[model samples]
Target chain A: MRATTLHGLKDIRFTEVADPVIEQPTDAIVKVIASCICGSDLWNYRGDNDITPGMTMGHESLGVVEEVGSSVSSFRKGDTVIVPFCHCDNTCPNCTFGAQSACVHLGFTVSGQGEYARVTQADGTLYRIDADPAPELLPSLLSLSDVMATGWHAAVAAGVRPGGTAVVVGDGAVGLCGVIAASMMGAEKVVAMSRYADRQKLATAFGATHVVETRGEEGEAEVLELTDGVGADAVLECVGTDQAMRTAFAVARPGSTVGIVGVPHGVQLPVHRMFRKNVGLAGGMAPVRRYLDDLLPLVLDGRINPGLVFDKTLPLAAVAEGYQAMDERTAIKVFLQP
Target chain B: MRATTLHGLKDIRFTEVADPVIEQPTDAIVKVIASCICGSDLWNYRGDNDITPGMTMGHESLGVVEEVGSSVSSFRKGDTVIVPFCHCDNTCPNCTFGAQSACVHLGFTVSGQGEYARVTQADGTLYRIDADPAPELLPSLLSLSDVMATGWHAAVAAGVRPGGTAVVVGDGAVGLCGVIAASMMGAEKVVAMSRYADRQKLATAFGATHVVETRGEEGEAEVLELTDGVGADAVLECVGTDQAMRTAFAVARPGSTVGIVGVPHGVQLPVHRMFRKNVGLAGGMAPVRRYLDDLLPLVLDGRINPGLVFDKTLPLAAVAEGYQAMDERTAIKVFLQP
Candidate 1:
């Protein structure tokens, strides 16, 4: 199978790799139907996070199960399923509390950015789709495997509710999807803080009532202005940067919460400021598993189109171009067909 | 008027100062009935926080309303009241949401250890006790002015639900009172983390199911072990230290909250750990004004005895000794009758 591999910083290649097989009794092999590069993928691609030669290129994916392990009761061959980026037992303390991202038995399953992948704990990690849909729906369904669930996780972790005001910091695909998630969660207002025109449009399309083309205090003031100086009721920190996290804190109203879903790079929270405002900060790696079942139906029902953030699509061989477009801010996220 | 003044490091003096009068249309002059030293006051007395000379030391007190400005509608001369340490308009956006401590028009209202003190937003800040409480009840009424309310705020902000497991971090008067508040709020198990014998006894009396003489990670481990490796449902942080904050995080169950009410000196949070655990951190300077209405009735009804934390008392002119006792750890708090 040909797969995208991260060999080094700014280094990626389409290389022939051996097909994946279930090594564990609870594992299942998936024929990757759709996969995409994640912003987190850029973390390793940019040399900030360590990556070995021939490492998996992506985590967001949906595909057809080609084989199931002997102990896998919930999945079988030819089943269409969504895979949470992280594997979990779904019965552990963390998983039961909906913090599957911190599941004690969590680890990365088979790399998604390949023609074939293997998933562990198939009964707990795999979510079968409602019904087999058309190929055109693949991108959107595949999104539920990661990006959409991630965005929903951000909104849920932030405690987004009806009549609540949500400020989404960062305008990448996950951030834009967060706007959709917040809107779906019944937020009265969704303010997407984005500087780029294209991403801003996507954010607006996802139901952002307000778009702030500013950053830092100015962005916070814009949210406050929209909220009549009280600040947003919920803040979703979708970009994992010190400044994005700071902006999330600045714009959240006192007694409200800030849910951060971005894969953190180096975030030393300004605890003094948080404590002073009585702000609740909660978020980490997206508990994608917790959100898949709930968000997938919304996508299938046409209540939301999270795939709008996928502004570009290409064949698997053109994956490098997709990465470049996202790197240069020309695309929110790209859908790749293998 | 006799007042406590910070003269230098480890030095406070009872000095003669001019009696205060109503300085604003919303102010009320009160003849000080009693004032006491707070744990935070020790920070200034110990020279940890900069305090200018003759700044009028006390922020908590019970007093007689000597005079009322034209705008003081609820307060009048001859009224006996407890002044909240924080003055609030009780009408700001933040205050409307029950965060009166962060009121937009918030102003400091400590009148020092003096004979006469003035309170701004008097109509809002002064919680009038029944006409004239008996001399025996004065001490308990004075406790409602700050520490008691501070503890209540910690418990309330931490979201101690009925049947929840609660841990009070810090053995100070506020922490002990937090045990009382959590129990009052229907917490099933209240664990008091204290090393001091007297404070632990007070915690036991206040409704702590378990009192552990533990600190830092050891304290967290004990709590986790006690709760079956899941941790407490709520934690009240009454000590503002990095270690205390860490303990709060470590002992909190997933989806639980940590209410921090301590006046932080140099507290840095472990952002990464907090995010992964899905812990909620909410706290601020206690909105004493908000809790006074709910707590005063409890104190007056003999449901709680918060003033038990005051181990010693002194005369008005002997406030310097009160500060010294608290500063030197000889007393948790010292009440000074003015």
Candidate 2:
């Protein structure tokens, strides 16, 4: 089998590797049909993160069940499925409370530009898709694995009820999808806080009722003006910077929640301000396992097209350039067809 | 009117001040029968706060309505009432949300310590007792104005549902009262985190099933063990300190809330950890206006006795000593009989 390997800064190569075989009774081998470059992937590709040598680089995909171990009961060969970024037992106390990412035995695969995923704990991790989705829908369906779920989680944690006002703080694909998620969840007013004109257009198309171009205090002020000074009922912080966290606090109404889905690079909350206002906070990595049951349907029915976030496409060899396109803000997301 | 005027650190003195008069159409002048020292007041007495000199030092009391302005319709002269710390119109958007503390046009009672509160926005701020409370019941009923309500708000905001486990992270009057409030709100397992024996006794009597002498990581471990490694379903943070805030977070389960009613001094939140677990936070000054309807009944019905928090009592002229006693930890709360 061939796999993508991360060697050093901007250095990724396709190399011959031993095919993955099930070592655990609960494990299964997934033949990857499609995968993609994530904004988070750039963290490792830029050598800005703790990247181990010869690391497999991704966790987003749609695939077929090439094989399953003896103990597997719910799936078989030739079954198509979506692999959530994190693996969990789904019966742990954490999973019961909708926090699958914090499961006692969480697992992940680094076979980014891969031909297969050796997913452990298969019964609880993979979600079978309907009737082998068309090849054109492969890229879109695969997104449900990570980014879509992340965006949906942000909206869900923010309590974006129907007619509720929601504000998304980041312009990344996840943020864009969060805007769509908020709308799908019945939010009547969806505001996307983005400075980029291109992303802004996509955000409006995704159902954002308004777009504010200001940053920091100005942005918060614009949100207030749009929401009639009451502030948003829910604000999603998709960027984990300290500044983004503060902006989330500044734009939420008293008693409203600031859903923060961004993986923190470094964040120190404004407790003094948040505590005084009774502003609540709820967000984390999308518990895609908890949301996929509902999100998958909207995708199948065409009620939502979260795939719009994938603004670029490339072959397996262009993975490095794919990372750069998103890193340079030239593309929202990039798909890799192996 | 004679009020306890704070001049400097530990420098409280009784000084003659002009009695309050009707300042607004809804304002009512109430002659205070009794008042108590709050934990937050100690902040100023210890010179740890930025309160100005000559400021009257109390926000808790039961009083008699001595005079009513033109628009005061809920209470007549001679009525006995409890004045919430915050004065609200009961018609603002904040009031509708049951967040009277954040009320628009909220009026402050500057001379809060002495008799004669020029209680503005009387309708929402003053709760008239069906009958005048006896001098003997004043102290206990007086606590209903602030600390008890504050504790109730903390528990309620933390989402203390029936049969839930609630951990209170403070053992002051408010913390102990939170135990009573949690039980009242249907919490089955209330854990009072306090080291002081006297406070522990009070907490136990108030229905705390467990009393753990916890102060940090060890305290968190104790709580997690108590809940079988799941942590408490609700956490009431009644202390305004960084350590207290962190403890509240550490002791709550995923999908639960950490209600903070403490006047935050300098609490830096662990946002990353909180978001990852889907924990929610909501708090502030007690929205006493929202709880008085139910809490006052518990007080009147004798189901709750919050006044027991006051271990010492003094006449109005000796309020300076009362403040000193509370500051020195010689009193849980000082009851000043006017």
**lDDT against the true structure, each candidate:** 0.84, 0.85
Model 2 lDDT per residue over A24-79, tens place = 99888999888898888877888768988888878888888989999888989989
Q: What is the TM-score of chain B alone in each candidate?
A: 0.97, 0.97
Candidate 2 per-residue C-alpha lDDT over B1-338 given as tens digits, one digit per residue, 9 for 90 to 100:
89989998889998987777887788988888888788888889888888788888788878888899898888999898888878888888767767788778687666667866778899878988856666667877888888999999899888899998999999999999999999988998999999989889989999999999968999999999999898898999999898998999998997788999888887777877886777878777777788888987787788998888988988889888888787778788888877
Q: Which pairs of residues clash in candidate 1, taking residues 3 or more apart in a chain or in different chains?
A: none
- Per-residue CA lDDT of model 1 for A42-84, tens digit only, reads 8887889877877867777888899988988888899988887
> What is each candidate's fraction of native interface contacts (fnat)?
0.56, 0.57
Kindly provide the TM-score obtained by chain B of candidate 2 when compared with the true chain B.
Answer: 0.97
Enumerate the candidates' DockQ scores in order: 0.58, 0.61
**CAPRI tier of model 1:** medium
